[model samples]
Target: MTINLTLRQLELFTATMREGSFTQAAEKLRISQPALSTAIRKIEVELGLTLFDRTTRSVQPTPDGRHLFAVAEDLLRDFKVSMQGVAERASGLHGRLTLAVLPSVAASILPRALMQLQRKYPGIDVAIRDVMHERAVAMVADGLADFAVTTRIAETAALAYDEIGADRIHLVCRDDHVLAKGKGALPWSALEGHAYVAMAGSTSVRRLADAVLLQADFALQPRFEVEQIASCIALVSAGLGVTALPALTFSMFASDRLTMRPLTGPTISRQIGFLQLKGRQLSAPAVALAGEIRGAYGKR
Candidate 1:
């Protein structure tokens, strides 16, 4: 048979047992003695067992009632602990956040943001997946990550992009390269015949560069193509060839060996932001971390 016992009933039963007097229990619970007595009767009826042995001026819990009281007390204690944990998580004081971020932002902006998040919410833990832009988007879309920090590669309704900032495209080359001697922003046409170190065709950086070069009616060809940003920086630093990269990714380059100039004559920049499933709300910790990331990027 199913026992339909509410927590309120358990509370009343336990209180009556502890106080050992119906009148005193009612006073402690802030209820009328009659109301408390009626509730006790309901519990006994529900369980089909006599919970108390009572006489004039005396009340005592029966063996069965004592056993139920022990179980109920433990359950109430555990419930209280569970609710406290829930409250902490809701406040973003204790929880885990998972983010899929581009390698560039992951290396540059994310470290400072995570440090800020840790200082503000020490109980929060974070997991980071540093991947390319397309993979970062896929991770968020597939529910493999809470959110993503990357460039908006395409327009789509499935994902909502909240732009935190933008990174301008820059031409990166060794400090001794002929182009490095020029001042101010350089026109896209100026890259004409230089040996280009192109990022892999699959990368967002390559796509942006290709689009800009195509629009400028420039036909520069790659002498070296590399997939990783570090490799591109290494090649450029070694004077193998110059590469175009966004300002944020320039953090990976060795400053003493390389220099970057902003591209002009229709300057190009990529929107950097959070990528998440459209219409879904982020968890409290995710929102807090996103704020930290925005602040870190803004400071840069």
Candidate 2:
């Protein structure tokens, strides 16, 4: 009969042959002697070979058993080395970590955080993607990203978030614009006549912005509406229109022509948070990266 003996059973045979007794093999395997005997019997039955020449005084390998021992030794050696490699990789703090962040932060906050992360986990390959919050959350859910940094989460089913920081919205305008002259506590009514560059009407941030204006009894004064915050910043810098964005967005500003004033009377803001799939456990490397994210924002 063809043998279906497992690598385990074969190892038991090898161990017993080396020790010359089931008791000695059991000691090496840290199992009882009867368990070792059962394993060897099962292996012999499957292979239809009397691998061990049983005698009252001692046990010895038959001629065919000696040949099988050579192969079994190599098999166990390769198996151990394979497991060692996996253990080394798992324990080593190296590999790729793909992260998703809002487009505004991609232009502003994330670069600084990435620089700090590179210092600690130097070998990690980091892939940063500029994505919308909805897409960012989905990216993690769909296994496209290891983490998502977002200002808000619309739905909680596929995602969970931990507050990393609080980012406040600031009203932005070109330096030459009329409202740019206004200082402390700009009134909500002041937004009525100014041309504004708002995010696309579809976004949650845009909805928050609209809600702020609505509560103030004013409609959005839009000269243009864009899909991305960087575009909104670009348009604002060009003096096309003004927009309100998180304070972190200001960090992206390299131009001297655009400036921000904190919106007052009613504050419009969203909290910055790290997101992951709700019920999934993070891999070792992902967990390590997440610790850095938490530490970075927690210290701030």
Candidate 3:
């Protein structure tokens, strides 16, 4: 036979069993004692089971009542949990957010944005992949990441780009280095004789640097090659070599031993922004995180 007891009946039944008195259950449920008894009686009638042994002095659960109560307790607990999850999803405060970013941006801007994202959506789990700018865009197109914070590219038919901010290129060198001897901005030609710490050829930064130098008819004198921006900055900080990077990168890897000088003679800058799949709809968490990134950029 199918049981037709309502959730209200089950709740009243459980409350009556727990309190062991109709008067006490009514007090806990903020209802009249007669109403509590009527609800529990409806549950007992629908289930065709005597759920309680009523006495003048005391009320106790029967053997069937004890077994049903155990099962109902777990059922109600799980139901409450499921409803809470639904609420969190409706509020856009649950789920995982995956993002790909250039190593420079991951270091410089992502941390602060993520911290803000966390505060706004504490139920969200964030995963960050710090890769080259090219890979950052590729991951978003390939569905490996929800979105990317990276520079623009010529080939973006499969992706959508939103320009959030632009970062001017700068030269990073040791404080006592010869290039740092002069004040104000330095020209691309000024880097002619310096030992350059270049990013690996696979990186977008390296490509941009090469193209800019080539356009200026300047030869690249590479002294060291590294993949991570942090490594390049560390090498420059140690007075090993000078490197060109976005001015925004300076704040993340800054050191008292190293300082940034603007690059002139056709000053170059890259547009950095959000990259997402062209037709795919972003999840709520990803949209929220994108807002955080944009807000951080606006503050800068």
Q: What C-alpha lDDT values do all the predictions have?
A: 0.90, 0.77, 0.85
Per-residue lDDT tens digits of candidate 3, residues 1-300? Answer: 887766677788788888889999999999998888888888888888898898888888999999989888888888899999998876669988789987778777888888898898998888989877877877887789999989887755788888898989988899899888878898999988888999899877788789899889979789999988879988888888999988777766757888688998878898898888888988888888889999988876
TM-score of each: 0.76, 0.67, 0.79
lDDT of 1 by residue, 43-157 (tens): 9999999989989979988999899899999988888899999998999988987899998898889989999999999989999999998889889989999999998757687
Superior candidate under lDDT, 1 versus 3: 1
The runs of at least 3 residues in candidate 3 whose Cα sits more than 4 Å from the true structure, single-residue gaps closed, are 18-38, 53-63, 90-92, 119-122, 192-197, 210-241, 251-254, 298-300
After superposition, the stretches of candidate 2 with alpha carbons farther than 4 Å from their true spots are: 1-88, 298-300
Give the lDDT of residue 262 in candidate 2: 85
Arrange candidates, best lDDT first. Answer: 1, 3, 2
Identify the runs in model 1 with alpha carbons over 4 angstroms from their true place: 17-24, 48-62, 81-99, 113-127, 137-147, 176-194, 253-256, 277-292
| Order of the predicted models by TM-score, top scorer first | 3, 1, 2
Root-mean-square deviation of Cα positions for candidate 1 versus the true structure, in angstroms = 3.9
Model 2 residue 285 lDDT score: 65
Greater-TM-score candidate between 2 and 3: 3
Best TM-score among the predictions, by candidate number: 3
